[model samples]
Target: MPVAYNDDMDKRLIQLGAAVIDTEAHAIAALRTRINGNFAAACKYMLACEGRIVILGMGKSGHIGGKIAATLASTGTPAFFVHPGEASHGDLGMITEKDVVLALSNSGETEEICTILPLIKRLGVPLIALTGQPRSTLGKVADIHIDISVEKEACPLGLAPTASSTATLAMGDALAIALLESRGFTAEDFARSHPGGRLGRRLLLRISDIMHKGEEIPAIPENVLLSSALLEMTRKGLGMTAVVNAQNHAVGIFTDGDLRRALDQGIDVHITPIAKIMTANCKTLGPDLLAAEALQIMQRHRINALLVVDTEQRLIGALNMHDLLRAGVL
Candidate 1:
């Protein structure tokens, strides 16, 4: 036997979920009004810090603090999360006088966090508190206080932390982005921090890094017959080949797909010159451009490959979409 919900109950649950979302959204939006001198002070303290920003929190705040630490660490700031409970045991040694501690507690009264505050104070470390209660002990004791107060919890019973947590997380993001902007963080700098991510591949990988060079490049002389060009395409295994003149300057390109189209028109591959059936205005890229830019060109034209050439229009390398795929840039 199983219990089933009526349509009325189902509608009520959906409405409840929607209300929760709307409430959280409103709370997060309200944070814009609270950004003032205190926020600026927090940023100044962090920017001046010679060591890491040590984040400490408990329960749900701990989870949000962890994410904030990661965001800060990846975006120019060196930060790490330390559990307040663990700090009392041995983690407090990780913090130094040069470091700044950011403590998060909705009530500004987490016993575990407060217990370690005196020890942190003795070491002359600056404290930044994010809490709903500005009048509480933690807020009063910290060097800087960020008010994250919310109108109400989204929970029906007002017990679960919903809107408050969302507001705090939004505040954390605000801090990270503000610091990121002040530091003049560039896409290349971000790529260095996230080398395993797609953005890293887009920013750090160049066309020459992934293009086929030497024998791997498919190329043939302009005087070669269309049949020999087809053989070169087959031997190199790229779908296309660069048609070079006697001076080794690329003049045109021939592809297997183009050969199919020529065959459909009853053209003879054995007798015709390769240039006769080649595409004259083939798309090409410079060896110094980013691989991502090359991918954009190939995708925009709906093509599969491109020839890498120098300013003199001499073929130096070649690449297909598959090359980008293998290099993890696609």
Candidate 2:
């Protein structure tokens, strides 16, 4: 009997969770239509603003506002969150004519947000509002109105922020991504804002930043015996040596695997010139190529090392899998 009772309770809890998700999904679908020219105008104003975007809200809206500000700032638009309550004191000084204000309120009559409107207006900063009520105080006074209204809250009591907060967050994401695309923001631009993160490492790392150059490059002349090539590969420990011609241009490559194959073919390492056993036209990379691309090439070729060459095919650098790992490009 106890098990049966607990099972029924679990079922009820699951149903409630599903209801909340469905309600929020519906709310966002409805909000999609509100993304017309008005939304574009707001993005335009933000793009042209020489100063930063100042976001404001209270309670759950405040939390969402902070996330929106972060997304906008990270994606190329500079932005920050100023709690409406704090702004009424001295935080309002953060706003200027060069800036833009984005205020969020479900009812659009939150006293904290409305109380500061006059000051922002006095500063001549453009105002954009995300509110459930277009006729409410915030929407009525804003230069742009983004309707974040919802049919109903997902809360069984229809009081908690659930569905409305989801809609507001979705709207915020819509605005940020649209602005990101309009500004032609690339992964590299986004990486600059997140230099300490993994995406930044992947997007900003180049082969030149990690490759071994100068004396670190392992190479042997085509006339060198296979034993000399093996010694060069051992000294560099990259498991390979570039075979360069009289002009010092890479003509072939000899790796540990190549040596093994040569030995199996009954060739004497002491007597054979490296040119006799080297793989000609081996895959080479340029200095400016992304380290991420280098990783791909190495993986596809099942090789552990690569020779970096110029357009004329002179060996300028060398790198192994370990170098990429140390540089965090792995």
Candidate 3:
């Protein structure tokens, strides 16, 4: 049976949704005060750690910890999440004296985490705690404690880990970004960690890696007729052809747009030289240029293709927007 819609109920539902977001936003904003000396101290320990930062949490906190660990690992800091419950059952062996342990618990008295506190302390590893209660067992024993308390949860019943989880995740991001800045982590470094992602394609792919080279490039002499250039463009299927001199140096580019303008001007394709119809001093990129930089040039110039040249302006390669799309760099 379909339920009937009530106008008052609809308004109440939207109001409740807005309230939840408002509460969570406030929760996250409140965490800025927690980024004081204690936050810096935690970062210092994690930065000095020779080994990975091992994260431990329970339930919802565990989920946040996993994401935090991933952010740290991708931003030049080596880290991984270890479930506290599993740690007591032998996963604790994953931690070593060289590593730093980061524990998250809203109340800071999680039994599973508390169960292994002695073990972590015995290893002489630095223990950093993120908890709401500074007096809790885990907080008291931590080498550094950064509070992640929220005034209240978004849940009206106040039973769910709503605002608290948001606060914890925001704090985790602050730590990861701070360490990333301190380590001078670059986009290239991040790309190395995410080679299969879009950012990796944009950052790591050079024009040489994706451009059509050698015989695959469409090229002709400057004296060639527009008919010959058009055939070369058709054969190469790049919608464009480079016109070079006797020295194979690119002097101009003849694209579909040039062809349209030539036809509009009643120029005979068979008799007109490509040089007369081609765009002179066309935009070009070097083989060593990044694909992303090439994209910016193409977009800025409102062009669809680019010629790849060497230091001597000799045509070595060619690429179009299609190539960037295929290479996942667009």
Candidate 4:
């Protein structure tokens, strides 16, 4: 075809893509009206369960069920996915009396899912169903049924699972997050569940986890010459040094910025004491604070480093942006 014709076809495809997104979005929004006491009852049942949430599904619903299970596990509620087909084999042994079974079937009549209904019932487990047909076999058999019905699929043929899948996923997120809040799941709790992730590192890491302590801490006496402070800064490579008094409490800090200012004033580095040119009463934080919190302090003060101190104001450690970056807290 001609170049112009190809360009026009591309624009039409883009318009169709946008329309599909809009249709899916509207389908999810429509679920807000369907959120009744049934939703609350489902949450209560899951919360009261003593064992893990065993989610079962087939095909696309199976894919979404796995994701929902993962979300529930990472948040507060414990959950895991089980293939309905696999349950027919020996995998059904994984189910226990304490577990709550969550089965997903939009039509509520998948033969595989319905076949295992009797087995699930025999275990004396509570069954929560996410289905379009609440009056169907699976829904009718479930202890609690959540309606995920949608007007239509986004596909033009109305044969593919689009809007219904979106609605199911949104409902799953709603249930998981609502249960998470009710359980008082905190950021620290989430961090523990995801210790390998960046958010986990940020929330769980303390300033002491990344700060330089002991002999590695850069320091100098308040009476030291400006040249001696510069030598200490270079040796420590922290670009600054805490100036301590006889009691070892920090009185001030001399940084590279201070050195530039001192040079601008034409001061003699050999004769002038660091206390004369240092920035006194600098902002300091305790080692117990989170490294993420310390990053915020550095951002608010527009500085590159902060000294860690005790309640008595004695310098115990030091760190800069480089430390935070290396620790993956930045």
Candidate 3 displacement at residue 194 in angstroms: 1.7
Model 1, position 329, has a per-residue lDDT of 88
lDDT of 3 by residue, 148-191 (tens): 98899999999999999999999999999999999999999999
Q: Candidate 1 has what TM-score? A: 0.92
Q: In angstroms, how far off is 310's CA in candidate 3? A: 1.5
Question: Clashes in each model (backbone N, CA, C under 3 Å)?
Answer: 0, 0, 0, 0
User: In model 2, which residue pairs have backbone atoms overlapping below 3 Å?
Assistant: none
Which residues of candidate 2, in runs, are more than 4 Å off? 1-6, 299-302
What C-alpha lDDT, on a 0 to 100 scale, does residue 196 get in candidate 1?
Answer: 84
User: Ten residues in a row with the worst lDDT in model 4?
Assistant: 1-10
Error of 4 at 98 (Å): 1.1
lDDT of each: 0.93, 0.92, 0.95, 0.93
Angstrom error of the Cα, residue 253, model 2: value is: 1.2
Best by lDDT: 3
Candidate 1 structure quality by residue, lDDT tens digits, 1-330: 756767998879888999999999999888988899999999999999999999999999999999999999999999999999999999899999899999999999999999998999999989999999999989999999999999999998999988998999999999999999999999999999998899999999999999999999999998889999989999999899999888778788888789889999998888999888898878988999999999999889988889999999888999998999998888
Q: Distance (Å) between predicted and true CA of 119, model 1?
A: 1.9
lDDT of 2 by residue, 105-163 (tens): 99999999999999989999999999999999999999999999999999989999999
